[model samples]
Target: MKPADIDEFFRRLAADNPAPKTELEYINPYTLLVAVVLSAQATDIGVNKATGPLFQIVQTPGQMVELGEEKLRQYIRTIGLFNTKAKNVIRLSEILVAEHGGEVPRKRKELEALPGVGRKTANVVLNVAFGQITIAVDTHIFRVSNRTGLARGKTPEEVERKLVRYVPARWKPHAHHWLILHGRYICKARKPDCPACAVRDLCAYPDKTSERDMLEDPPVPVPAG
Candidate 1:
């Protein structure tokens, strides 16, 4: 896509959702950190299903530590890789309590230092929890990027770099959310609902749904004499 088109693409996205937010439900930075970690390879609905009850009980690193790995598994067992995620959450929580004084770290290096918190998770935490202009290239965003030719790349890191460079400064903050939501609801992996997509005309995908048949209205009946 051209630079101007990129700007307009984001303009439309931002206009539609002025204040985009992560789908993962959390009360604070700590919970948001843990939720993003758990959300890896899992759907937001799946993560929320587990975290809804888990957060009510474990709001802090201390609570997570006290919950123990065995108990932690019970809370997040529904998500994929529950065993690994449970262990990492426990480990990271302990680090937060001991190293960061129980507060989620705002810096990417500090966040990535935590177990199970990778570049993607760190980006999400920085963007959503700390209000930074970072984009976490998840599967949804990755697909959208390549499919729309918005930021074509073979890897997440490459896609992230392109997105940061191509996206307008004003829209960088919410770019991740917009792309993710668009891919999830409209430009899906299977049959995309291009006809309903807000940016379908602006999209570069050649296989997008045809807009030709969608007429505005039939000819109005002649007025009675």
Candidate 2:
């Protein structure tokens, strides 16, 4: 999209949700990191359901380490890949306690060094927990970016790079939240609600779906600007 359109896209999103926040619940950076890790391949609502009681007991790395793998598994057993996630959580908590004095690290590299914490996880931690201008490209953000022609790329990293470059500085800090929420609620995967979309006019998706998308033969093509 052109620079002006890109700015307008975010402007509408921002206006609709002036203070967008992660749907995942957390008390602190450590819990936030753990929530993001658990959120991999799982929904935010699902992760929150498991983490709600867990966070109350384990707020810091030391506390999480004390929770132990077996017990942690019991807590998150409802989530997918609970065994592996439990092991990673315990080990990463140990590392954090031993190295970072039980606090979540602000640096991206350090954040990624933790078990189950990849670039996307690190970006989320840096952005939501540390207030950085990083955009973690989840499935939602990736689809939204490509569908809207905002920052099309084959991979999430490529899209992240393009978004970092394309998004205006003023909107960079909140871009991730805006895009993710917009994608989740409006520009959905199976069928986007183009008619209700705030940025429908600015979106460049060739085929824009609406409320009757499920019953329709094909979605209507968006008109040229």
Candidate 3:
């Protein structure tokens, strides 16, 4: 896409949602980190369902450690890879307590050093929790970025680098959330809702869904790719 179209693309998204936020529920940075970890292969709604009660009981690393891995597993049992996620959560909490004084680190390197926290997770924590202008290229953001021709890349890391380098500074803070919401609701995987998409005209996707397809059947839900 041209520079002018790229600017307009984000402008429409930002205009639609002046303030987009993560669907995951959290009380503070500690809980935000945990929520992002739990959301690895799960839906935000699912993670929120589990974390809603978990956060009410444990908001800090100390509380999470005291809750223990076994107990944590019980809370997140519905989520995929609960056993592994539980262990990482406990281990990360312990590190936070021991090294960062129970606070989530602001730096990407330190955040990634924690168990189960990868680049995407660190970017999310940095952007949402710390107000840093970092884009976390999850499945949703990945699809929207490529489909809209805003920043096409074969890998998440490549797309993320492109977004950071190209996206306007004014739109950087909420870019992730806007793209995420767009993909989740409109530019879906199975069949994008092109008719309802705000940026359909600006999108570079060649195989746009037709009005007949939208009327015939709703798009099937697919796992994020």
Best by TM-score: 3
Candidate 1, number of clashes: 0
Off by over 4 Å in 2: 214-225
Q: Model 1, which residues run further than 4 Å from truth?
A: 211-225
- In candidate 2, what are the lDDT values of residues 1-225, reduced to their tens digit? 999999999998888888888988999998999999999999998999999999888898888888899999989998999999999999999999899988899999899899999999999999999999899999999999999999999999999999999999999998999888888877878888787788988889889876676455343332211
Cα lDDT tens digits, model 3, 1-225, are 887888898998877777788888899999999999999999999999999999999999999999999999999999999999999999999999999999999999999999999999999999999999899999998988888798999999999999999988888888898898889988988889998788999998999989898987665442332
lDDT against the true structure, each candidate: 0.88, 0.90, 0.91
In terms of TM-score, which candidate is stronger, 1 or 3? 3
Task: Give the clash total for candidate 2.
Answer: 0
Native-vs-model 3 lDDT?
0.91
lDDT of 1 by residue, 7-120 (tens): 988888777777767888999999999999999989999999999999999999999999999999998999999999999999999999999999998898999999999999
Better of 1 and 2 by lDDT: 2
Tell me how candidate 1 scores on lDDT: 0.88
Descending-lDDT candidate ranking: 3, 2, 1
